[model samples]
Target: MDTLRYELVFSEGTDSGSSAGDVVTVERTSATGPGGHPVYTDPTGIIRAEISDQGEVRVLATGGHQDPAQGVRARPLPDAEERS
Candidate 1:
């Protein structure tokens, strides 16, 4: 069993209607790693996410599971690009 740890940081104005400290849903799936190894052993499931006051997104995963190296990454949307 391998343990994976990571954090996502949001800039600001990520959520359209919701405020900064809102929770969001996230999902992950099983996939092969860079060396072609079984990463995740379970189907994807929805997880709750929270945005900090400083516009930072954080995800907490329970259980000792290996995260897929190449898969859909769940994170808060960053600030939109300024239109010229």
Candidate 2:
């Protein structure tokens, strides 16, 4: 599995209200979604995202409550770490 790290920025608002404008770590998973897009997971394990080859992000719910994050932007991170 090829692992990569990213910084996810939420400028708008999220499902969970607390995470708006929060920056979170997102790691690439071995799994792939539609069109062979790579799947990523947050440190909280509540946010699952599918990033397309074109850099489009599709957030997936884990059937639980998560901190809200509005307009999201994904940035490549040199290192990956869990943060609250």
Candidate 3:
């Protein structure tokens, strides 16, 4: 959806150069759930990623919370992930 977004963090890689470290991100969205609302992540998610030369995104690690399910608290756009 247009309202949803992912906040990404890029770090320098050892070999991959610029394309590397293009996958670390946190997705945020508004929602109503047992977690009280504004669940940060889906029920399950990928923690790490491995991008290929063809630009294919590969999930390296996965995790989730059973009860709350939310990964973070909702905050202001400027304080949190910002879109250009």
Q: Which candidate is the best by lDDT?
A: 2
Off by over 4 Å in 3: 1-3, 13-20, 24-26, 29-39, 42-44, 48-84
- Evaluate model 1: give its lDDT: 0.33
Give the alpha-carbon lDDT of every model.
Answer: 0.33, 0.70, 0.35
Candidate 2 ranges with C-alpha deviation above 4 Å: 1-3, 13-20, 64-70, 79-84
Clash count (model 3, backbone only):
0
User: Which 10-residue window in model 1 sums to the lowest lDDT?
Assistant: 1-10
Candidate 1: tens digits of C-alpha lDDT, residues 1-84: 222221332224454744344333332235433443323222234332333333333333444694412222334333224222
**Maximum-TM-score candidate:** 2
> Candidate 1, 18: how far from true, in Å?
23
Go through the candidates in order and give the clash count of each: 0, 7, 0
Which window of ten consecutive residues has the lowest lDDT sum in model 3? 68-77
Alpha carbon lDDT of residue 22, candidate 1? 30
Tell me how far the alpha carbon of residue 70 in candidate 1 is from the true structure, in angstroms, after superposition. Answer: 12
